[model samples]
Structure formats: C-alpha cells, structure tokens
Target chain A: MSAMNKQILLKSRPNGEPTAANFDLVETPVPTPGAGQFLVKVIYMSLDPYMRGRMGAEKSYAATADLGAPMVGGGVGVVEESNNDQFKVGDYVMCGTGWQSYCLSDGTGVMKLDPKQAPISTGVGVLGMPGLTAYYGLLEIGKPKAGETVVVAAASGAVGSVVGQIAKIKGCRAVGIAGSPDKCAFVVEELGFDVCLNYKDADFPEQLAKACPDGIDVYFENVGGKVFEAVLPLFNDDARMPLCGLISQYNMTELPKGTNMLPALMRAMLTHRILIQGFIISYHFNHLPAFLKDVSGWIKSGQLKYREDIVEGIENAPEAFMGLLKGKNFGKLLVRVADDPTRN
Target chain B: MSAMNKQILLKSRPNGEPTAANFDLVETPVPTPGAGQFLVKVIYMSLDPYMRGRMGAEKSYAATADLGAPMVGGGVGVVEESNNDQFKVGDYVMCGTGWQSYCLSDGTGVMKLDPKQAPISTGVGVLGMPGLTAYYGLLEIGKPKAGETVVVAAASGAVGSVVGQIAKIKGCRAVGIAGSPDKCAFVVEELGFDVCLNYKDADFPEQLAKACPDGIDVYFENVGGKVFEAVLPLFNDDARMPLCGLISQYNMTELPKGTNMLPALMRAMLTHRILIQGFIISYHFNHLPAFLKDVSGWIKSGQLKYREDIVEGIENAPEAFMGLLKGKNFGKLLVRVADDPTRN
Candidate 1:
C-alpha cells in the first residue's frame, strides 16, 4: 500500500449543473486506525445522483456535505488493519469511506463482505444500496400485484433495473423507459422487461401509452421531467407511485417557466385515487435482511441481472458523476479506486 | 300529495364558475310505483362540492351527470307509497333521490332511516357522507399521531370541519384554514380546532405558520390553490396528506399562470418522505358501520357538534350551490326541499 491517500473534496457548490471545478482532488497521508477502529483501502466507490444533493449547502433529507471536505458516499473496501475484534485484516467490508482511496472507521455501519458469496464490488452495487432501494420502494410503496402493469423510468440504470426485474418476479408486466434505443433493448432483452421505450423518442407519450394498454398500476418514479409527464395520463384507477428520485430535476437551478400545473396533477391523482409517496432507503433499514435474502436467491437462480458502468481512478469521479446526471453512463455508475485481488 | 313532481334539471355545462342559468326548474307528471318499488317524497337534499365535478362532461372518479337530467345528490325522504315488502307508508329512508320532489326506488342502495335515532338530515351531513369522509380520510390516510399538528383547508365547510373535529378527537393539534373571519372563529370555537386562520387575510401564511409552532404532520387537502401553497413549506418529515378534494381549483377553466412549481412541490414531498394519497369515501364503504357507531357516540357525549346551512325550497338550490363554491355557506350546506316531519 502507498503512504499517500487520494481524496476528492467538494470545493464549491454548483448553481445549476455541476462541473469538475466543484471538486478538488487532493493527496493526504494514509489514515491510521485507533482503538476499536479499522483502516480500509477503498476498492470501489459509488457515485450516485444523491451525492449531488449532499454537495449543496441546503438541508435535504440527509445532512449536507461540508465543503472543502471529502464528499460523502459508500464503498467496498479491504480491511488493512483492525483494532476491533469483529473485523480482521485481509477481510473485505462495505463502509462509508466516501470519495477516498483510503479511510479510517470505528466499525459503526460497517458490514463485512464475503467474497465467496458474491463479487466484492456488489457490496456497493446490485446487492447493496441500489438493490435495497429498488426492493423497498417497489414492494412497500409501489406494491405491484400479480399481472399488474408496472412502469419505471431510468429503466437501464441501477435502481430502475432492479425495480423492473422484481416487478416481473412478482408476476407483473414490467415496462421500462430509458434514454436510448440500445439501452431500452438491453432492458427488455437482458432484464426481461415486457417492453422498454426510449423516452427521447418524439412520440414518447404515444409509445408509453401503447406500451401500457391496460394503464399503469404501479409507477416506479426514478427520473422525473418529461418522463413523468408521459406516465401521468396513463395511470389506472388506484395506481401506486413510489417516488424514489427525480434525477432529471436534480441539476435544475430554478423553477421551470410555464403554467403552474399542480392543480391539474392533484386532480389526476384524486380522480384516480393514486397513492404517491417519496421514500429514502436509509429510513427503511429494517427491510435490509429480507432484501438481501430475496435478491441473493434471485441472482443465484438467474432471475436477476445487473450491469455496471465502471470509471477507473478516484480522480475521474466528478466527470463520471456529471455523465451520470446526463444519462451518459450505461448502468450502475462506480469509481474504481484500487485493483481487486479476487478478480485476478 | 301533489299531482306533479318538481325537478332541477341541468340546463347546460358551465365554462368556469357555474351560474343559475345552468339549472332549469321543470315539472313532470307524477308516476305511480311499480311492484317491489316505493315512492319517496324528497324532504332534505345534500349539496356538496363534489357535485361540481359531476356537472362537467369530463370523466372524474364518479360518472358525469347526464345532460338534461336531474342533478345527482343524496337525500332523505318519506316513503309516501310502497309496493315493496321491506318499506311501508310514512317510513323515512335515505336514497340517491337527487334534486327532485319525488323518486322511485326498489331499495338497491336505500337505507331505512329511524327518525327516533337522529335527525333525518344527518344522512347527508355530520352523521353521513361528510362525517365518514372525515373519519376515513383522517384516520386511514392522514394517520395523525398524538401531539402531531394536523392542518385542514376549507375549515368551516362540510368535510374540513369534520376533519378538524376528528383530529381533535385523535389528540392532534388541529389547525384550520377558512375564507372569512367568522368561519375561522366557528372552526376554532365551535369545531374545537386548536387554531384557525382566514386564508383571505393578508398575512395568512404567517398566521398559519404561527398557529402550527410545530411543523404540520398531516395535511387534509380540501381546498388546493393558495392554501396548498402555504402548507407546502410547513411540512415536517414523514408528513401524511389525505388529498380529498381541490375545491378551490374545481371551477378553474385553465391552468394558472406563472412558474411550473411542481418541481419545487415534488422536491418538498421527496425531502420529507411525504405520503400524499387521493381517495373517494364511497370506495371505503366497509368503514361505515364503525364510523356511524363512533360519531353517534361522540354526538351523544357532546364531543361532536354540527352546524347546518339550510336554504328553504328546491328553487334556491342553484344559488345556494354557487354560494358554496365561493365559501359563502357557514356549515354543512343543505336544501330543505319539503317539510321535515322528523324535525317537529
């Protein structure tokens, strides 16, 4: 291991869309573990749209990330040294190591990863935060019943992909909306979605309506904006909407210009008896055990499939994240910080 | 008995706010009851805000009122003639007699009304549709917890008044919003709400915020224009919203001008993990038995108080309904079409 640790710190908040200048890559001395603490060599760092909210000074569901400090995130890491009995050297673990190459933790919220069970990178990917987000948001909030039509936006991305797959497993007609035709094809073919439509199509609304002939019963809201507008009129009576994220609006600086259509939206919701709820996965930690068991079984039986969009080097996280906001990444966006021993 | 049956027919659909010209007073030859059918002499008719939605040609949760047909509503009447084994002369019953002097029914949805139990008018007021709407919307959807602040709009109207009273029953701090000072006073003093703010006041939002020192935990949305704007910023984490009606926007012909603030609204709902669900009371008929028992008990113990805005004569129903849209009625609006034998 190197004596220097590379860290990406939030230099400033962005007014609208973020740029690389907002983040500063710095090198510091490798952190040492203290009593009951452990040092982790971060191997894979996750770059999610949620990190953009944390970078701002405004109070969100989660606390804001302090400027000039390492950006907050989760990662899969190798335990280099441990002062705690629960973790040992050479063991892999999932930790909130943020956007850093090396970090020190006191074992709180740290879960040891078993490499023999699944891939180590999955601790921060399909079998981790994104997977659990899809599990709870789709099952608990959306509650897709058998043979019901379930629609999800950002269909080829991390969370939406899992949501659609789970909907299918629950005997639903899973439909997906993606940015590109190729991604749509991948979602329908590889992910086993009933249908996948490219939201960028000129006839997106018509296409979405045609895809959901019986109307949408469960709408997994991931990317709001034009995509949401397409799904609104197709909602069936008693539809359930699990509002997970609005990635399309995350980078918006101000309220968009146009008529205040909230009245119309509320009317549609009321007329259909739709249940729209926003949820954060961290608030539902009690669901994690069931999520892990079911998802692991699905993966083992080849009932679940996942794709990763890996960007090598911690220094490239900002660019990769900016691409993620623009739908530039193909699947789950991640920053590879170090070489994986189990891979070779 | 009169040889003619008087009816209020829908003359035409209104563009924005309905006018008296939209209704026509018509008389038809009285028809005799068939076998297994009974004739009901309508006495007291209920006029609710939801009736406005039915007037429109557009499809809402309920079916639209047919053109040139008697306006749809609920009423209590005396069975003047009966050929059915279940009903006899002089028996009071609740039926969907609409806006008419007489209606014939075979008891599909008709319920026998005992004048000895409670006022027959209550079949549509505090002990009937409006009361059950409050009970189910507040308890089932709003889920108000003790010490939590619950805010209800159109505070002095049929649904809102009951919602505020029930919130008090559940040990929640109930804040109400009405259109005038008198209505606000009634909501606080008569309805037993913790506080009531007049939305017509210049500093309405400030007053609302002051009333709810603790952020709003549940918002029973009845009026949905300016009142909703004020409540949006005061929502606490895990807030629940029972979206019953948008009475304020029911008369709107077009979407309001200005910034499309849905993004901001979605952001608030997401940050708070708010659950906003729209529901129709008729869909929850199973709750009626419990609702009747609890509300009857409350009325007997003086824990529940009710006020009725009674307008005499069926000819005045059009003007009274228009007044209701403008928040002119003091309490539950009712049209005493004929003599209420149970009253004296």
Candidate 2:
C-alpha cells in the first residue's frame, strides 16, 4: 500500500475558457480509510458540462469547487481496502472521487456496481449519472407523448444520445441537433433519431424547420447558444423544454449580446402555453429505481444504445474536459485512470 | 325589434400602443335573433390585457380581432328578446360580444348568470375570468405550498388581486408588487397580502428582497419588464412562475436591448429546477366549474375580496383601456355600456 496518489487541483478560477495554467497537477500520499470507510483506486472518471459551473464563483445549485482544491468529478473504481460492512477490498464502487488516482469513501453517496452485468467504465457513464440525467429530464420534464416531436441538441453526446433513444422508445419522432455531419449521421443511423441536422450548417435553421413539420413538442436542451436560437421558432404550442445543460455558453464571460430575444421567447411562451423547466439529476434521485428499471430494460432489449469516448490516462483528463466543451467527444467522455486488475 | 344598435369596429391595427384611430363607431338597426339565438342589450364590457394581443396580427391563443369587425371582448348583458328555448327575456347572461351596444347569442359559450346570488358584473370580473385565471394560475402553475412566499405583480389589478387572496387561502405568505403607494396599501390592507411594495419606488428591488426573506417560491407574473428583473434574483430553488401576462413589455415594437438576460433566466431554471409556464384562462376552462365553486365560496365567506374600476359610458372604453395598461385602474377595468335594469 505504498502507492502515491496523483491529483489535479484548480490553481485559479478561469476568466472565461479554462486553460492548463488554471490547473496544477500534484502528487500526495494515498489517504487511509477510517472505520466504516473504504478506499478506492480510481479506474474511470466522468467529465460533464455541469463541471463548468463548479469552476465559476456564481451561486448555483451545487457549490463551486474551491480554488487550489482537487476538482470534483464522478468516478468508477475498485476498493483497495475496506473497513465498511457493506463493501470488501475487491468490490467495484461508483463515487465522487475528484480527478485523482484514488479516493476514500464512507459509503454515503457511493454505490456498489457489478462489472459482469455491463462494462465497468459505464458505471461512470451510460448506466450512471449522465444516463439517469437523460432519463429523468426526458420522462419527467420533457414528457414526450407518442407521435410527438422530441428534439435534442449535441445529439451524439452521452446525455443527448440517451434522450433521443428514449424519445424513440416512447414512439416519438426524435430529431437530433449536432455540430458536424458525422455526428448527425451517427445520431440518425446509429442512435435511431428520425432526423439529424448539423448545427454548423449555414442553412441549419431552415433544415431544422423542414425536419420538424409539426414543430418541436419537446426540446431536451443541452447545447444552448445558436442551436437554441434556431430551435426557438420551431417550438409548438404547449412545447416542453427540459433545460439539462448549456455546453455552448459554459465558457462565456459576459452574456451574449446582439440578440435580445427574451421578449420573443416570452411571447412564444405566452401565445403557445409552453412549459420550460430546469433540473439536475442529484435533486431528482427519488426517481432512480424507475429510471434504472426502465433504462436497463431498454438497453437489454437493444432499444437504447450508448457510446463512450475513453481517454487512456488520468493525466489526459484536463485536455479531454477542454475538448468536451468544443463538442470534440463523440459519446460519454471518460478517463481510464488506473489498470483494472479484475478485468485481466 | 326597431331598436338602434351602436357598435365599435376595428378601423386599423396599432403600431405599438393602440390609439383612438384604431377604432370606429358605427350605428345600425338592431336585427332580429334567428332560431336558436337570443338577443341581449350589452351592459358591462370587460377590458383585459389579453385584448391587446388580439389587436395585434400576431397569433395568440385566441383569434386576432378581424379588421373592420367588432372589437372582440367579454360582456355581461340582460336578455332583451329570446328565440332560444334556454333563455327568457328577463334572464341575465355573459357572452363574448365584443365592443357593441347589443349582441345575438346561440348560447354555446355564453354562461347564464344569476343576479340573485351575486352581481351580474362579477361574471366578467372577480368571480369570472380574472378569478379563474388567478385560481388555475396559482394552484395549477404556481403550486404555492403552505408557508412558501408567493409574489404577484400588478397587485391591485383584477388577476393579481385574486392571486394574492388565493395565496393567502393556500396558507402561503403573499407579497404584492404594484405601481403606487395607494395600490400597494390596497393590496396589503384590502387584498390581504402579507407585504406590498411599489414597483415605481427607487428602492423597490431592495424592498422586495427584504420583504421575502424566505425567497419567492411562486411568482404570478403579469407585469414582466422591471418587475421580472427584480423578481429574478429573489427566486428560490424550485420556484413556480405562472406567466399569466407581460403587460409592461406588450407595447414594445422590438425587444429591449440593454441587457440580454435570457441565458441567465435559462441558467436559473436549470440550476434551481424551476418551472416557468405561460397560460391563458381559456386553456383551463375545463377546470372552471370547480374553480367557480371554490372561488364563489371564498368570496361568500369573506376569504376573498375584489375591486372594480367602472367607467360610466361606452364611449370612454378606449380611454379606460389605455388607463388600464398604464395601471391607472384600481381594480378590474369595466365599461358600463348600458344601465342594469335588475339592479334598479
């Protein structure tokens, strides 16, 4: 048990888009687990758009990550040592372990995972936080009725992919909005969206309008800049918008200028009786059992599919996270932090 | 059947705020009611914020007022002659007659009003459309739980007054936002709001922040320019916004350009799991009978109070409507088109 723990700590808050200089890589001694606690050697870490808010000083639902502290993130790992009754030394667990090689947990927020049932890394990706996010956000907030139109931005990403697939399962016409033709093709062909339109296209708005003839009934909002601008006019009467994330504007220092469309947005809402709601998965954990039962069944039946973009080393986490903001990742963004002895 | 009929028609569409040039008064001989139709002499015409949207060519929940036709409105009138079996000459009824001195009804959308139970004018005001708007908007959209702080703008007006009273009935702390000290005092003292603040005051935002220490759980939005700006930061997590109207910004030809706050609004919705829904009363008409029963009971029990700003003549309707937009009316704005023979 002489292994040293390497972690990434925030050196300072980013002015706008974060840079490597804003983060510091440091090595420290692995922490010991106290009574009723377990120690985990990190295997895979989940990178999400919500982490951007944690980097800012603004008051949000979740607390901002403190300056000079290890940046917090969800991770899937194996217990190296255990003093807890519910876990053993070899048990795989999912916990919030920050960007680090190892973490010590007291079994509060951590959940045990069975690697044999699904891919072990998926405990931090599709079968975990991001999957649950898409599940609750769509079912509870979006509530897409059969034969209705459901739209998702960043459609090839982890959450959006799950959202579009779930909408398809519910007999909806799933329309995906992505950044590139490849992502659009992936969303339509691989992910089973009824239509996929690249946001980068010069005629994206017109294309989206043509794609949704009946107008959008439910919009699973993830990327929220120009994509949202394009989608606004196409929203139908009584449209439901589940505001899950805003990856497009995460790095913005000042609010976007040039288009004051708030009044138009308000007018649309008033005229059409639209409902727009915002949610985080943690706050809606009460719906987890139903989510797991429904999503797991969908996966086993091959009705819902997911993909992962795995970066091989813990040191590459910072770069992978930065690339995520630019929509460079094709699927659930994960970092393979350590060797899985059980897999071999 | 030889009575002369006076009617107001739409002469032109308004550019921003409407003026006298937009309306034309025409006189014609009153025609006899056809089979299954009844004739009524218009008594009271209700002037509401929703009428403004109808004036514009833009699509709203209701059809836009057609050019060179009678300006659409809701009115309470006494049956002067009857060809329909459902109504007699002496019966009082409420109908969508627009701005006119007489009307013919097929008794489809019109409701029979009992002058014995309450004033017939209540059919168009507190015990009617405005009352239903308050009940459904607060209960259905706002969902004000007991002990939560509920805020309503345009506090002494028809819809806001009912909203504040209903919040009190639901055991929530009711805060009212108005334009003047008189209206503020009326909202607090007469309407039974827990606290009332004048939106015109320089320290209005600060005072609002101080008044709602628990933060705003529900905002019954009617005035949406500066009042919404002030209410934004005060909103608590999971706040419910029943966006009933946006009277303050209704006259703007273009969106206000100084600060674009849509992203911030979207962020607040996402981070806090807030629900913002826009609604018109007609959409919730199915719940009207139940709402009427409950609201009528509250009014009878003295648990709910209402006010009306009645102008004496039909010609003054335009001036009164303009004043209603400027917040000059103390309560529900109604124009007395003809004398109530039942009251005499």
Q: Work out the iRMS of candidate 1.
A: 0.9
- The number of the candidate with the highest lDDT is 1
Share of native interface contacts present in candidate 1: 0.82
True contacts kept of 2: 0.71
List the lowest-lDDT window of 10 residues for candidate 2 chain A.
A255-264
Which pairs, if any, clash in model 2? B73-B98
lDDT of 2 by residue, B183-278 (tens): 999898888899899998899899999999989999999888888889988889999999989998778888877667788787778788889999
TM-score (chain B) of candidate 2: 0.98
Fraction of the real A/B interface contacts present in each candidate? 0.82, 0.71
Clashes of each: 0, 1
All DockQ scores: 0.85, 0.75
TM-scores for all predictions: 0.99, 0.98
Kindly list the per-residue Cα lDDT of model 2 for residues A252-288, writing each as its tens digit. 8888776577777888888888999888889877887
On a 0 to 1 TM-score scale, where does candidate 1 land against the true structure? 0.99
